[model samples]
Target: MSADPAAPRLSASGAHFSVWAPEASHVWLCLFDADDRETRMPMTRGEGGVWHSEATGVGAGARYGYRADGPYDPAAGLWFDPDKLLLDPYATAIDRAFIYDSALAAPRGEGGDTAPMIPKGVVEAPLAPLSGALPCFRPGGLIYELHVRGFTMLHPDVPEAQRGTIAALAHPAVIAHLQRLHVSAIELMPINAWIDERHLGPLGLTNYWGYNPVNWFALDPRLAPGGIAELRETVAALHAAGIGVMLDMVYNHDGESDAEGPTLSLRGLNARDYFRHAANGQLINDTGTGNAIACNQPMVRRLILDSLRYFVTQARVDGFRFDLAPALGRMADGFDRRSPLLEEMRADPILADRVMIAEPWDIGPGGYQLGHFGDNWLEWNDRYRDDMRRFWRGDSGMLGAMATRLAGSSDIFSGAMTRTVNFLAAHDGFTLADVTSYEQRHNHANGEENRDGHGENLSWNNGVEGPSDDPAVQAARRRDHIALLATLFCSRGTIMLTAGDEFGRTQQGNNNAYAQDNAIGWVDWAGRDTALEAEAFALAALRAGNADLRGAAILRDADVAWLDESGAPLSVAQWEDPQRRRFALHYRGSGLAICVNGDGEACKFLLEGQAVNVAARSVRVIPPAR
Candidate 1:
């Protein structure tokens, strides 16, 4: 390989390109100019199977792809086709939308020519560098998990073209709405370039949530108005509004699922090296999606780290919420607290100041390592969600667990590590509205019977199931929603609210609506119940006004005070009582008091060391103290 300055640099060149096709004898870099001109550039095969090429004139707005000439074999997991135009794994921008031609689908039968359906490589055109963006939010920051499309697809104010893309999110009206909601950061569901799972695409549904990642470095062209550049603009806009952008990254697995899955990018290039294989040479199925990424390997670790660095340094993202993060921490032995990947990320110069959050578990052996992550990392507290749900739904023997969760689950995260990402619901499960309206899962709309989502939702239907026109049931549901929000806001950790939860968004009881990219998943901005929206807005305001409540200190007197049902100090007996369902938590420093009644009937809660002047059903946050 020549060290020419004009040659493409994978990390630096504006029109640089690289591919991993060790088995290929030769690879060609093809560029299609704006005037429909074709330029064929040969790639130099470097050490470690990486092919590279660069050109001076090839830059932003250029359309290009790659072609590899290699031996063809299906059983061995090498399906190389020189005729197909592959996308670059590192391409920062996509010049065109992915056209779903039948020829592009995975080839069937005895593998006559099975490469067109696979991921294509390309030489990316570079745009302006992303710098000057600061990390505006931290671990204790409030995060609102939202779908870029879903948040504004039905928004009356958003333009038609911008409705479901990054452009919509950057709209001033959208920014103002989020600002009014009072969250510090927006944890967007995955926006990485992904292909709809073949089955979902066949069913006329798309991968709406964007969890299946194909190219870690490229933004999904479908989500961006002008491709990747639009994504950068959206991030910049969010940062300008004092809101941090945290991407939900799926590094645990690639879009390529299993043996039957399509050979998108990484798998076709080097399946054996990229994916974990059993001793018998079969693909490991730890991700529950057919294959697991080889995170323990040094080169694989470097790839993952390099991808993260690219996003941080180039994309200027504020933080990353790692999806199925336990897979990253898995080692040859088992889940390790000091995993090389985790340690490297913690110490990395570019990643050190960013917020590092983890889903904290996978489906593999010892996969449920929730509280086992390192100190600098914030974990999704599933235990908090479960316990809080049980308490609110009138379950017994949950008082202790609820109390522990309210105190930031100190048992899971001890000392200074008590900061958790607490939430009643996220994108994966039923929305807060659905949780209170459906006792049983109604995922038939997902076309997978009712067996697609989690069986144990820990939800209550409030005396009726599904949607109910009964005003009483509706009022109860609203109250339950308010209670859950209050609990989340007053809890001793960072809080995350689903996008539509604030305005009562329902998936119509479809908990796992990953494939429903249309109306099912999109937030109905026009159909919002104004009263409920106001309540949500008020809850956010209350949370913001009481800074001590969301502060990092576990023993801090500024935010929290324990009180009995009568608003007096909690007694030892009351703390130990399994039947107790009501407590008063007062943020003395912030001068806000919240009374919670988890019991079926209302309970009179007293303010500790203060006279009880006001009361409401289930839960209520008192105004700031005079």
Candidate 2:
């Protein structure tokens, strides 16, 4: 579906590269030797804004880069300094570790050659067609999101050498954990090659969240010790185990921060055309990052589609979750659900059946298109997150909103056509444990003076802040933890749980642990709660075995009944009661009644002829006639 693709096409004799750089009068394909010696060969220019070249004896594992000589004007957004060894936009593998160097920061002046300072792309062979069929990780299935590094960094069962690597995620222990939760897919946080923000090194922090992407196709060396092969192997293992792999992609923008950021890939080649700049040539900031990509451009769109197809055909990933996804739907006038990019992806034969999840918002004007995505695209439901948090926190008049959320958030995602990926916490926010342990975000460790993360987290401390030693506070937090997980599993539509949240994991109340790549961010397997783990398994089993809960259609009046403490359907007066934190939802024919009592004291609910007592701040899933 791409206009021009397969940039580096491998041939029988050698590898051929076709780059799009119309403005450049000349472009050099630079290859490096084992001693890091450079070999420069000029590429011939052709019509349609393409540059082509082929080199013999250069197939797989060959290190290469490109230098385009055109114009250099920051104000005009030219950014064409040939001194920088720009990474190939279509690079599939990269060599060496990425250390944040100040020299790589801004184009302050015509910087010297950066070949010795930065990593270069590796020439890799094309992937063969998979022997088996793709995994059927349907859109509405339960998804477990996790970070490769954080999930395995502190996992004692994984070998030390494989820890934090793509290979580590395939360990038997990790597989068992996902199986226990009955997760259909694992939406891995961005494992693509990324850069640590220039401000992090000076602040003694690291870019642990992986949002600041540098190379679109290559895997980050730190996270992929064995590169693309390891990723493919890991995904195959997951597929064999009946679990799907979904990648969190960041195509909305690049790591080239601002005019003052790194000249890594797109920025160095042709900033004026590759990036969206104002009339005065100022970079657009739609992504909240320094520069928003001009994806409407044919070449940029080609790059995105090519990278996507590569992963599907090569790595065998089941799907993708686009971060800050609104940027993908932006046209000249505004965001369009039928934008060329969105239409192209949907029409593509390879991507149509695969799962596509959109974050569905950006920092640009008219950007929050929550429920505005086209058909077949599932979206992250922030409304569900807020309502669930508020209701469980004992907020007044939250019962009505909670009812809507419980029914797959039909108020927003009305279509039984597309499902919602409902989650209480993700990588960018407080972990489930932190949600009940801290009222406010404690991100002082992020070097931003506790001012980095979301201010209004809708979280409660139970009775004390941070870690609690008091038995009462500890007991209450543990109960609320189970209650939140229960609500997620019981809610209609697909649910997502962050890794390590099953047995209680905390980031010390730091909602924005994007820069805290230490023990605070890693999962502590040694300290997991065994009892809570069993409870999580039971909850998963409950959701999996219920046909009504996993139905493909939106539930309406006859399908659901909102009952009061008397076991009868609630009246208008009772629905409006300020103290109606206690309620029950009897899913028709599911034979399960999910009762919640958010009060500070125990409450009794009439279940059929018997009055069953449920403890306060707890959620109980009862079977009919039990």
Candidate 3:
């Protein structure tokens, strides 16, 4: 079940329970009945800090938890409390979703038994490993990132009972929509079991993004009522439709915050080895979530690797995008490309071929390790997002930068093939529509006094801030949207588009809507722009039809040419001109070319003996001459 073989495994006799609590004075396996009563079974200490116990009649669907009693010294990071019921790190299912309470975080002796408040790990017999299934997604394909709850919550066709659940994704309407966009994969934001932040309860808010995960293997009951089975079925459905599934995993930190946080699972078992700490005995705040996972530790690495293997073999997911990925590659020496955990994942037979993308940054020291992830990894390129935004905003001297990004940011990635995942907007920042309508983040609703999100969004208001009734302003915004989408599809390497961005979804200027689990966070299906959606579909088709646009390799000198309006090769002066906006890229022998007009007025570009009229603030895919 694990490196130390600690997770509950079913046996012919009954069920076997084990856990690793190195310094605990005593540990008890807490078994609960249908009426919520608990039975304590003492465990025997074994080699390597493992505690083992056998239940003669325990079987699948039985709810259980662990209680480790030991030194409760906060300074030393030994947070063991028998009163706090701890979850199993390898649990595949849970009886209920976690709801935070002040008592859960109360001091070791001050708190009462949390058995009723905490969720118990439900014993589940493992499903047979999915065989003969390979990932359906390839790099340089469209990755549609969406929150499972937010994406399906407002869908009119989805049944009321299925809304906001993983099963809803398998509904015909959702699958049809993904097929329309030619989505290569659906990158689901964290679906693992998570808990609300401590401060969120007071403000009547919750962590809508599911970044604060509590257990790695358990599916949050709020999203997946059927647990791992639901996920497996949905994945099978997506695979049947030729779509892949990618999970946004949060291994950097757990929902357990600082010293004052609850002793849910890892903290109660072994916080000293599970989480990173400074020499002064304080938790390291690398993830900005009050604690950073000690991924460098042997046992912690084993647990993470086991979780990945479980998802791949059981759920048949395509790959993973690591949130705050620097933590996984971090050690006492800081972020390293050759970190042990990273190496193991790349070399592991189960995970070696899976797509591994990185957020590539954290708030830790030397945390931004963008292009340093080495080969076999794709990174979320903020440079592509920022540069593309700046260029379309008509910022001077942005032509060169935009060209570089469109060509897959070869400067940042020095490999033969680029590993950049070019994207305009993702789950963290402003939606595509908000990027053109809001000049600043309106996050007052986040309860952070409007100071929570990114300050400089590289965004422009297009002559009007927020929603505008002015016809000209609205028209300009639409044009900008089309132009931005065309640039993305025409770019090299893998590309990601947020779920609602194609149809003009907005957060009402609230860039940081992580706390808004209501209407603000849900995708507005009724209000989507049909024309813009059609435009995105056409762009996807165009990208799919052309090899040059989908190719990951950088364009060679012989294959592509940067030309002026007159169709001649561009000179250094023209390339360096800060005011230059109009340019054409001609791919020799491909019968396909692209013309970009960044100015506010339309212009004509001479291409292959014909003058092509290009609209202002737009990009045109010029066809070959007949």
Better by TM-score, candidate 2 or 1: 2
The local lDDT score (0 to 100) that residue 12 gets in candidate 2 is 84
TM-score, every prediction: 0.91, 0.97, 0.99
- Which parts of model 3 have CA positions greater than 4 angstroms off? 1-3
Residue 287 Cα positional deviation in candidate 2, in Å, after optimal superposition: 1.7
Residue pairs with backbone atoms closer than 3 Å in model 3 (clashes) = none
Top-lDDT candidate index: 3
In order, candidate lDDTs are 0.75, 0.84, 0.91
Please give, for residues 394-424, the per-residue lDDT of candidate 3 as tens digits.
Answer: 8999988898898879899996789999999
lDDT for model 1 comes to 0.75
Relative to the true structure, candidate 1 reaches a TM of 0.91
List where candidate 1 sits over 4 angstroms from the true fold.
Answer: 1-16, 32-42, 54-59, 69-77, 81-85, 99-125, 556-561, 586-592, 608-617
Q: Using TM-score as the measure, which candidate wins?
A: 3
Q: Which residue pairs in model 2 clash with each other? A: none
Per-residue lDDT of 1-626 in model 1, one digit per residue for the tens?
53211113444445566666678788878777655455778988887777887666655456666667676665565666665556666565555444344444354333433233443333444555655555888655689899987888899888887788877888999899899888798988998787767677566677788878877777776787476567677878888898988889998888777777765566656677778887766788888888899886766787778778777766688889999998888887788978898889889888888888999888899999888887888899899888988898888777778877877787888785476889899999999998888888888878776889998899989888888999999998998887787788777778899998987989998899988877888898777777888887887787777665676556443446778766667788887888887777776665567677776665555564555533333667777766
